[model samples]
Target chain A: MSTTTLLLLLVLVGVLTYLYRYAMIGLFASRSLPAWLHALCRHIAPASFAALTASGLFVAGGEVVFAFDTPRPWAALAAVLVAWRTRNVLATIGAGMAALYLLKLLFPT
Target chain B: MVQIPTSAGGEFLAGCRDEAPLLLGVAPFGMIYGIAALAAGVPAWVAQLASAIVFAGAAQLVIVQMLAAGAGFIPIALTSGLLNLRHVLYSASMAEYVRHLPRRWRLLLAYVLTDEAYAVAVLRYQQRHAAAADHAEHTDSGTPAADATADLRHWYFLGAGFTLWAGWQLSTAAGLLFGATIPPEWELDFAVPLTFIALLTLLLRERAGQAAALVAGLGALAFAALPYKLGLVAAIVLGLAAGAWAVRRLGPVR
Candidate 1:
C-alpha cells in the first residue's frame, strides 16, 4: 500500500472506530437507560473480560487450540487463583508470568 | 494501601498509579505491535501514527495483518470496524458514569478509550459506586460529600487514558527502532491475556457474574472460528444473557 493509501486507511478506520466507541456514550448521554439495559450493562465488564481472557489464553493463529502443551492455561489458572485470593492486579500478573516462564522451562515444547 | 483520591488531580494521579502495573503487559504488547507493523511493511511513521489515531490494539494489529495480505481499502476498514464493534458495548456500559461531563470531555475520553483503559477506569468507577452504596447503608442521609468527590472520577479516567496512550506511542517507536532487542522466546504478548484473566477474576465476585464469565469464556472458544472477531461479540452477548438468566433464577442478591 502506498503512503497515501495507508494514511487514508488510518484516518478512515480511525474515524469509524471512534464512532463505535462514541456511539452509545454520545447518543445516550442525556437519556437514562431502561432497567433491563442497565442490568445488561452491569454484566458487560465480566462478559467482555472473560471472553477476552479465554481467547487470549486459548486461541492461537485464529484457531482455538485446546492442547495442554502450551503454558498459557496453567499460567492463567495461577493468575486466576491469585486474583481470587488476593484481588491484587500486580500479584495476579506476577503469578501468571512466573508460572508461564517456569512451565516453559520445565516443559519445553 | 494507596488512598483513592477525592480531588481531580489526586484522582488523575491515582489513575496513573493504578494503571502503572498493567503497563508491564501493555508496554511489551505495544512494542510487539510496532515490530509486527514494521514487518508487515507499514511505514514507520504511519505505524506510529496508527498507534495514536486508531488506538485500538487488536484492530490495529488486524489492520497490519490485512495490509500484509494485500487487502484493499474497504475490507480493511470494514474489518477494523467489525473488530472494534465491541467498543460500542463498552461505551454503553460507561455512558452513565461519564454522561454528566461536558461534550468535549466526553469526546476526548471516547477518543482515548481502549480495552485497557476501559478496564481500569470501570474498576475505579465501580469502586466508587460500591463505596457510595456502603456509605448510604450506614448514614441516615446519603453524604453529598462523597457524591461531590465521585463526580471528578473522569479525571482519573483521563489520567489512565493518557498513560496508556503515552506508553503505546513510546513502545511502538521502541519496537520499530529496536525490534531485535526483545526476544520472541520471552513471549511478552502472553502478558496481555494474563492481564485480562486478572481483570476477569476481579469482576467475578457474584454468582451471576461468575456464570456470565463462564458462559462467555466457553462461548468464545466455541465460536472462535467466526470471522471478523464476531465470536467475541457473540460470546459477550451470550455471557450477558447467561448473567441475566442467573439473576432471574437465583433472585437478586442484596
Candidate 2:
C-alpha cells in the first residue's frame, strides 16, 4: 500500500475504534445498566480474547493445522503453564518464545 | 453514588494507579506488536504512529498483518473495529460509574477506556457499591445515608494507562530500530501465539470461563479457512453464545 493510503486507512481504523469504544459511554451515560446486560458484558473480554488467541495459535497459511508435532501448540502450552503458575505476562511470553526456539533447534525439519 | 471532586492532575494520577498491574500484561504485548508490525512489512514510522494513533495492540497487529498480505482497506478497517468491539461493552459498564462526573472527566475517561482500566475500575466500582449497599441496609433501611467514597481506583487507572502508553510507544520504536537485527532462525514469531495462550489461561479462572475458552478455541480451529479473517469473528460469536448458554444452564457461581 502507498503511504497515503496506509495513513488514511490507519486514520479511519483509529476513528472507527474510538467510536466503537465511545458508543457505549455515550448511550449509557445517563442510566444504570440492567443486571442481565451487566452479566453479559462481563463475559465479553474473555470470550473475544479467547477467539483472537485461538485463531492466531492454530491457523497457518489459511488452513487449520493441529498436531502434537507442531511447535506452536507445545510453545503455547508452555506459555499457558508459566502464565498460570507465575501470573506474569512477560515470563510467559519469554518462556514460550524460548521453548519454541529450543524445539526448532532440537527437531529441525 | 457519592461524587468525589478531583482536579485534572488528581484524575490523571488516579488513572495511572488503576493501570499498574495491567501494564505488566500490556508491555510485552506491546513489544510483540512492535516486532510483528515490522515483520509484516509495516514501515517504521507507520508502526510507531500506530501505537500513538490507534493505541490498541491487537487491532494494530492484525491491521498491519492484513496490510502486508494485501488485504483491502475496508476489510482491514472492519476487522480492526470488530476486534475492538468489546471496548463498547467496557465503555457501557464504566459509564454508570463516571456518569455523574463532569463532562470533561467523563470524556477523558472515555478516551482511556482500555481493557485493563475497565476491568479494574468496574471491579472496584462493584465492590464499593456493594459495600455501600450493605452499609446502608444495616444502618438506615430507607434513607440514603452518608457514605465514605474512595477515589483511589481512578488513580490506579491513570498509572496503568500512562505506563502502557509509554511502554507501547517505546517498544514500537525499539522494534522498528532493532527488528531487522533479530534472526528469523530464532523463531521469535511463535511469541505472538504464546502470548495469546498465556492471556487465555489467565481468563480461564472459572469453570464457565474454561468452557467458553474451549468452545472458542475449537470453533476458531474448525473455521480457520474462512476468508477475510471471518474465522476470528465466528469464533467470538460462538464463544459468546457458548458462555451465555453455559451461564443459563449452570447458573451463576454459588
Q: Evaluated with lDDT, which candidate comes out highest?
A: 1
For all candidates, state DockQ relative to the true structure. Answer: 0.44, 0.54
Q: After superposition, which runs of candidate 2 have C-alpha atoms over 4 Å from their true positions?
A: A1-9, A24-27, A34-40, A67-70, B1-25, B62-79, B118-160
Segments of candidate 1 deviating more than 4 angstroms: A1-17, A20-29, A59-65, B1-47, B56-164, B171-180, B225-229, B252-254
Q: Write the per-residue lDDT of candidate 1 for residues A1-109, one digit (tens) a residue.
A: 7899889989988888898788778966656546676567567778877776777667665688876767878888888889889987668878988999999999987
Error of 2 at B208 (Å): 3.4
Worst 10 residues of 1 chain B by lDDT: B141-150
When just chain B is superposed on the true chain B, each candidate scores a TM-score of 0.68, 0.71
Instruction: Name the lDDT of candidate 1.
Output: 0.78
Candidate 2, residues A11-104: lDDT per residue as tens digits? Answer: 8877777776666566556655566665555565566567666766667766876767877778788888888899876789888888887888
Write the residue-wise lDDT of candidate 1 on B1-254 in tens digits. Answer: 45777788998898898888877878766776777676667778889999988998767766765565455676567556655766777787788788767789999999878888999999988887777778789776455344654478999999999999898898889988875456667765555566667667777788998999899999988987776556766787899899999999998866
Q: For this target, which candidate reaches the highest DockQ against the unseen true structure?
A: 2
What's the C-alpha lDDT at position B208 in model 1? 91
Q: Which candidate is the best by TM-score?
A: 2
